[model samples]
Target: WAYPMQPIQSAAMSGIGYSPIGPVEGTWVVGFFRDGENAQDPVMLGTIGGIPQNFPGSDGFNDPNQVYPLSNLNFHGLGEPDTNRLARTIGTDILGRDSKEHPVVTQKLSTTPLFDESTGTPIPYPGVPIESEGGDIRRIPKALAEGNFWVEPPTDAPFTP
Candidate 1:
């Protein structure tokens, strides 16, 4: 059986710079997973990884000539936006290979993923807050790490070690 499914949205960011500190190039990865108990697991839904974009003020990298990829994990604002603010992006880029075997880019912007400041609950599937002591939040990661949520030998390599 087959049916179209809405992409499950997830994002990870790095190399963020703001204010007196100039901007650095940033990258993000979005993953789509099937719905179910194994939603955290892969259900044939693939992941888009290593997408690149620049910080607010930089064309590419703050140090474009640097020999290695720079990381800016300094954004301290996740829940405290008033205390610390950061820049972000949201959209979709469909990647594929054409007849000539070249990459194709198709970008679409639908709804934006907004954080619910109204709720204090940390997302419960990935892991515990590390501040709390127990619950599915604590058990889920250990289970996933041991291959319980999804089938063994995930279709795609596990992103975490």
Candidate 2:
């Protein structure tokens, strides 16, 4: 889903001058995958736009016309697994596009095949284990207390959140 940022303000010194603010106009792709999921490796789950090329008032502030790669911005403040929630919530910032608010305009992208299509068999990635179910993988809290199961967080950075 692409978040398109609009120019909100213009330079104070010159009314016609550029705003020199907000995210650039372009496309960005965000992906999520199971540690070893095959068939659909590196799933194309979503896209976002209006990502800031640079923070306001920072170095390179004068060059509003220059476009930078979206990957350079701070994805670190995203916090944790719940970062997804934040990204969805903050649909349009002073800079980036938020996914939660603009479902239609954001444009959801996916790599999964259509169910009715008759194509080649799904191939699993080498050495990747497939989970039997396709749903929330969290263990039931009650089940754990009853000694029916145990749950632990994956040490892997990507899976932890």
Candidate 3:
């Protein structure tokens, strides 16, 4: 079954799992299905570790020093309500630099297909223009699709002097 690409902000754990590059606050049970497989046939994709249980209340986990509950954290289950807030938190945690001082993440298109709601047939997702030549729409065939986790900064892109 082909899964449509959703922006990192709103996509389910499957698409997001392929990238595996952000903060998720709860332990997640991600499920995966083979192409053309029934939704009921999903195989275990394994679990994601959420915020440590012991994290202090100020940081928002149940306890600053214990392992956190695998199901209760909202950010892990639903994501930050505001992308900016998510961006800033991840920016600080992953890069150790201020989100204001550097670009947090770059958006890219994926060739995953969104299935028809009722018939379950694959359908092309609407396209959007991007700064690059072809715009942000991903046009590659899903069988040959590849996911990129790195960004190439321009020669003039800002850097610490």
Q: Say which candidate scores most in lDDT.
A: 3
Candidate 2 structure quality by residue, lDDT tens digits, 1-161: 63442223211111111222212222234556655656466654443333233433424323354333212222221112212211233222112124423313233322244343476665322221111011112213344446775444323312421
Model 1 misplaced regions, further than 4 Å: 1-67, 70-87, 99-101, 106-109, 112-161
TM-score of each: 0.18, 0.16, 0.22
Model 3 lDDT at residue 30: 59
List per-candidate RMSD values in Å. 19.3, 21.9, 13.8
lDDT of 1 by residue, 1-161 (tens): 53222122211222122111122223222344666666786443322223234323446423345411333222222232211111232213323334333445534332344445688544323321110000001112446557665423213323332
Candidate 3 per-residue lDDT over residues 28-82, each given as its tens digit: 4456776445566656454443223332355433334443322221223223222
Give the higher-lDDT candidate: 2 or 3: 3
lDDT for each candidate structure: 0.28, 0.28, 0.33
- Extract clashing residue pairs from model 1: 15-72
User: Per TM-score, what order, best first?
Assistant: 3, 1, 2
**How many steric overlaps are in each model, in order?**
1, 4, 14
